[model samples]
Each structure stands twice: as C-alpha cells, then as structure tokens.
Target: MALQFDATEYAARLDRLTARMRDDKLDALLLFAQESMYWLTGYDTFGYCFFQTLVVKVDGSMTLLTRSADLRQARHTSTIDDIVIWVDRVNADPTMDLKNMLSEMDLLGCRIGVEYDTHGMTGRVARLLDNQLTSFCQIIDASYLVGELRLVKSPAEIAHAERAAALADDALDAALPLIHAGGNEAAILAAMQGAVFAGGGDYPANEFIIGSGPDALLCRYKAGRRTLDAADQLTLEWAGVSAHYHAAMMRTVVIGEPSARHRELYAACFEAIKAIETVLRPGYTFGDVFETHARIMDERGLTRHRLNACGYSLGARFSPSWMEQQMFHTGNPQPILPDMTLFVHMIIMDSERNTAMTLGHTYLTTAEAPRALSRHPLDLIVK
Candidate 1:
C-alpha cells in the first residue's frame, strides 16, 4: 500500500512495444483486450464489464472508447495521453461511434494486428468496418506478439507485484485465525476478502476459491453454502490487483487438526512443488520443466495425481509472463528468461471428496533461480 507507480515507466514500456510493432509492419495495433489495455495504460477498468473497448496507436498514445458515463472515471484513472468518447445512446446503435472512430483513424487495410482471441471483436463490428470503410484491412493475430513483450517484468512491476503478494499473504494470515471446524466456507471467504480490502487492495476479478469437505475436488470451486468440518481440508486461492498489477496466492488449510490422509496429500504436493522449483533456471526448456515434475511424481509413485504444468508466466498486468509451457492449456514453448514472473501451483485432488489440496505461489525469474515473490507459509495450516 505504500508503493507508488511511475506512469512514465509504463509509457516508456508501451513506446518500446510500439516501436517493435512498427518494425513488424503493423500500421496501428488495435487492442480490445482488457488485460492488453491495462498493460498499455496503467489503469484497471472494471467498467469494461459494461461498455468494453480500448484502442491503442502504434505510437503509444491511446484512447479508450466506452460508454459516455464511464469516460469521466476512466479519464480520472487513465495515465494515457488521450481519451476518445463513445456515447451509448438508447437504441442508437453504439457501434456506429466505434466505426466512425476507426474510419477517422484511416485504419482500413493497414495489416493491423487484432487481439481477437482476447478482444472478443464481434462479427457485427467486423462487418461494420468492412462495409463502412470500403477498404479491406488484414486482421492479424497479435496476442502472442504483445504477450511476449509483457512476459518479462520491469523492476517497478516486480516491486508492485511483490507488494500485492505480501498483501495477500497478510490477508491469508488474518483469515486463517478465523477458520474453524464449524465455520462456513462463505464466511471464511468474506473474511479473507475483507482483509484484502483493508489492506487497500481491490479484488478486481472477485474470483476467490474456498472449498472444504468433499467439495474441494472441483478445479474452480466457488465459495458456497458448504460448512467446514472437523476432518475437512480447505483451499483458499485469491488474487489482488494494485495499479493494474496482479498478484495471485493460494494455499490449503484444514479445520481444527488435519487427518492422516490430509497430511499425505499436503506433503506430496509440497514435495512436488519443491521438486519443480529446483530445476527452474534460465535456458531451461519448457519441456525440461515439465519433465522435472514428471520425474518427481514418478519417483514418489504419485504420477496419477499430476494435474498441469508446474507453473506459468505472470505479470502485474494481464499479459503473459515468461514461463511459456505449451503442453498444458493454451501456452507457448518459450524458455524462461530473467525478469520473467511465474505463477506456480501444485495440486493433488481428493477423489472421494471431489476437492483439491492446492499449494500456489509466484516467482520472479533470475539468471540463477526463480525468486520467490510470495512469502506465504508453504506448509498446510491447521486451525
């Protein structure tokens, strides 16, 4: 909370990316992805959940086109040089304003890169430009290009992320004292979120996981009506954003004392994460990272519990981080590099209860090792 962000540093970062875009034959990169927008401009727009669209010029000066009502707050928080106003009149066809802006910029047929995968640019908007502009513009996939640039963290970004991680750590510490065998999972989640807010952090995504008993096996478990039991295990994974930088931390805790089975699953996951962390260094292949975990699981005879890759790149913003492993999910095979941040979680699910026992943390990659940005207690906590 005591940290201050340098907007000039962010502007310079975007300017560098824009320079690369120009060299790559991009006339002007049209970015509509929320994460991409935040990366380019150091502002978090939860308002995107309503009127969602932001445009970025290759030269780094940008404008966010959204509902007229949102423009005021967006302006207040925006660190960019310009703001384009898009009035959403009732039954007035808001797309017209967007079409007009594109035409004014003369972006047609510019070999533009569209972050369509994340932008969600609809067919209607695509057709609108095609018909109104009277010119054909080749829309290229720009997700990876921008994602690669964001993979490495600047010192400032790492600092903010470290602070965010610390906030999460404290929040977990505050919430853990309130956990009990008879506590409701929902109540525990509320306390955790309250701690986050009290730390002056905004829960932008509002995605927190709290599961216990048989309900923890689900991968994306939501806090529900379930109550913690004396023998039940609980998982709490949460994230917070500071100055558009995101920090994620997750841990497993037990109500009262843990059972023998809980200890086994927890220990195995911790050992697996430790095994995965030991082999992480620059020049290591993504394949090698995966094999490290594979070897550990095999050695422990726990191969059946292997869930996903050991970890992935992370950033303060929503762009990709450096640990690009392609085997699992939508990832790249890119190697880890210095200044790259990674979010890693090793989990072993309880088949009987349909819940997961998770251990998660963030790492800042260095030439020798991935530095631990997360300082949360790695061992399973017992209330």
Candidate 2:
C-alpha cells in the first residue's frame, strides 16, 4: 500500500483511537468523516461525499462500507481489509444495507458511536441513517472522538506540516510580482497555485481566497475576477498542502499609497496577532486565544471590524475545508497543546473606510513557545 505514513505510525494511531472508543464505552464507531477514516486506516477517497462509512469496532477490527465505485479505491489506498460494497441503483436505500451489516457484526444492540458532525454526513443521509438504526442499536454522538485524537501531531505528521509551510512561502513569492497595479487576479491566483504544484504540493482542501479593491474586505472566496488598481488592497488567503496536511496563511497587501485607515487597521492586526502569540502555548485555552485577539482589537476601537474567531487548528483534511474541530473562538475550552499545528489570523475589515488588513501564519506549538512554519515575516506588503 502507498500509505502516507509507515506501518508503525498507522498501527499506533489505530491503537490510540480504539483505546478512546473503549473508554467511551463504544462498541463500534460509524466514521463518516473522510479525515477520520484516512487518519485511522489510510482510507483515502472523495467517495465520502456520497453515502459511505468506515465501521471501526472497539476490538480494533475495521470494515469499509462504500459503493462499488470506491471498491478499488479502498483496496488501493487503504489498509482496510474487510470491504463491503452496496449496490448503486435507482430508489436504493443504503441505510437498509447498513442495518443488515450491523446485525451481522452482532452490533444490533451494542452502543455504537456515530460521527454525525461532518461534511461526510449530510442531512439526508443522517436522517435516513437514524430512521434505519436508531431503534436497532444504542447510538451515541461521538463526532469528536477521532478528531480529538488527531489534534496532537506525531513526528511524521509534523514533518509533513513543515514541508507544507515551505510550499506556502513559495506560493507567496510567486504572487508578489503580479500583485501590483494592472495585475490580473486570474494570473496572480494561477501563479500562486502553480507554485504549490511545482513544489510537489497538493491542492488545498479549500479554494485559495483572492479578492481586490472593495472585495478585499470579504473573507470567503467568491467567484469573479478583476484587475488591481494603482491604489487598492488585495487580500489573499491560501494554504500549502502536503499529503492532505495543511499550513495556511493570510495577508492583505497594499497596492500603492496607503490611507490613514489602512495603516490603522494594519497596526491593529499586527498588535492582535503579536498578543495572540504570547498565549498560543500550552497554558492557554482556545477561548483564551480568541479573547486575547478580541481584547486587542476592541481596545484599538476596531471591534466591529474584526472577526468573531481569530483562527483554527490545521491538519490533514479533504475538500471543502482544511480546518479541524478545535478553533480559537469565544467560549471554546480546548486547551492549547504541544505538537498541535494552529493558524493565528487577525483580519480587520472596515466597510466604512473601505479598508482591509489581514496578517496570519501557521505555527507548531511547543513546550515554551510556538514555532512559525513559514519562513516569511508578517510584514505589511506593498507593491
């Protein structure tokens, strides 16, 4: 198998996961998240977008229930041995198939843990699943079981994160020359993504965010393209991906002469991110990080301009997002831990002044302080 990690690594991960399942009194786990499956058994497939699940029992035995389309996909990319295929046909209800499979494994009355909170578990599929299995077994919401275990990176995972960081820096370098006036957003975006591919990196789990002028204030990626003006702002949020692991970065570069408001917002972002760094270590909570950013931004009188969350955990993820369950948001109690990869961002968007300023980078948390993955400094870019 072309597993990203060695046999020993995969074995250790499986051991840790099942140990947690047993602690939670779970007889088996219905893993709907592709990240969860991939993390546990190297089951790589986009087929999770459909109805598919990896059934992991407390005994550490595994089975993948997917469509025939992903039969070869599972065999080729995963360590999973017991693969069961559900036929795909019109008016077919795969939930019935799942019910029968659960009975065969003697899990009908067992306490089964299901990952209900993920992109892999759509509302339709979840509803059908509950209808079919709720009365048959004891169902528990164990959405964060595998995600919690995956938070602290091993040495091998950290190495992939470091390589991804290098790719992000290369991407930034490639886009710098094309960020000036008259530059095309398409060309700039192409150059940035091209750099990652050339550096042997995979496409990010999410689209690279690119916007200029008034659109710079937007955080989410939207369709539409335009040219950079002589005096405008361009916001770029992108991630470097290696073997599905991510190290994300964000920045808003000045095009020409900066406005007083632009400088003020940048100053606020700089102060907020720097303040966050002090609390990004083991002693702080995810909530503490957000509080730190919130206080700094509010103290600067930029409260309305700042986002609710400062940043989130980064790791091996599939399409739609690279963010993990842990996040730097208000009231979040997840403690900062060593060997965790986190992204710290301070985005100040001022609609009144039509200004935007963002500064962020990925870091690997340690005992003393967090180490920045990117070699680039958080300097205010202007071209």
Model 2 scores worst on lDDT over the 10 consecutive residues at 267-276
Over 4 Å off in model 2, which ranges? Answer: none
Candidate 1: which stretches are off by over 4 Å? 1-4, 50-52, 90-96, 119-134, 298-304, 317-331, 353-355
- Clash-forming residue pairs, model 1: 109-137, 216-355, 216-356, 217-354, 217-355, 245-316, 246-316
lDDT (Cα atoms) of all candidates against the true structure: 0.66, 0.93
Q: Which window of 10 residues has the lowest lDDT sum in candidate 1?
A: 321-330
Q: Alpha-carbon error at 197 in model 2, in Å?
A: 0.7
Which candidate number maximizes TM-score?
2
Global Cα RMSD, each model: 3.7, 0.7
The clash count of every prediction, one per candidate, is 7, 0
lDDT of 1: 0.66
